[model samples]
Target: MRGTEPPVTPDGRYIVVRGRLWRKANPALDAEARQTLVADLMKARRAVRDAVRIRDDMSLRQARRSVNDAKVALGERGPVWWTDGAPDLNRRLARNTIYAEWYAALPEQP
Candidate 1:
């Protein structure tokens, strides 16, 4: 995966790059809440790895759900953290939009 950190929109609600949009992390989350979510995410990730190693389908499915839930809580997936109705663009990569020039200026990912 590319490591480039996309530029945030003027309002700071979204990161736009290559004409795609990504919701920023929830700024309203308290430090404790963020920490707890991170812990849950890490635990789920470990569970996934262990399940794969053991070739356990049930465990893997449960672990994947947990991972998704954790990500949603962390504002990394699911609904947009912002309430403004800006469409959710969690995973998009295309061209021709307001931010195209900015995206073009970004250094290419290796």
Candidate 2:
């Protein structure tokens, strides 16, 4: 993601929005920061109970911050991540469905 351009669809319809393609002004730092923030958001979501019980304003704010961090990082790359890797990564991710299944089956550690 740091050095590679993103792919575009053959029909130029869709692009891979996530993974290593996303970048920012400072791509390396921003990408890692975004990953950290997303991971934190996931942690917060998992820590909560039912929907009604998850209403912690502070944590919600933190999730917003994480979203902003990721958004800012993506902006820094100036669309390079989206436009460049669409074809190759999209096919790769689609074909690698089994990897996703395996990943989803992994146990989460608290």
Candidate 3:
């Protein structure tokens, strides 16, 4: 897949670019990394929602990139999941640690 531009969903209602799950829950996406992630998600979301006339254009790499972006965004560096400062249902996870942990164990960079 060269440039699906957006790895759309099956029904076209949402995009699964990354585990960030872009659709209705899309937030302010305040950071540079978050912004980039949001951009990728939007592309995938549009692909599903507006991909008509064409099919099978998105590549797995793009989809994975989007997902990674989201994952990073979801991590602590992106935003706090809640204002209460608690790791509850609506709390955002810690970023620096999460990101570090993710790569620290990696055998090599992709």
Per-residue C-alpha lDDT of model 1 across residues 7-110, encoded as one tens digit per residue: 77666766765557776668899999999998999999999999999999999999999999998998978777788887765656534545556567766734
Kindly give the stretch of ten consecutive residues in candidate 1 with the minimal lDDT sum.
91-100
- In candidate 3 the C-alpha lDDT for residue 16 amounts to 30
RMSD of each: 3.3, 11.2, 14.5
TM-scores of all models? Answer: 0.76, 0.28, 0.27
lDDT of 1 at 64: 99
Task: List, residue by residue over 1-110, the lDDT tens digit for candidate 2.
Answer: 36654443334333333422222233344667767755754554554333326787666666555555554444432243444464323224422443354333534312
How does candidate 2 score on lDDT? 0.43
Q: With candidate 3 superimposed using the best TM-score fit, by how many Å does residue 105's alpha carbon deviate from the native?
A: 44
Q: Each candidate's lDDT (Cα)? A: 0.78, 0.43, 0.42
Which order, best to worst by TM-score?
1, 2, 3
Task: Tell me the number of clashing residue pairs for each predicted model.
Answer: 0, 8, 7
Best by TM-score: 1
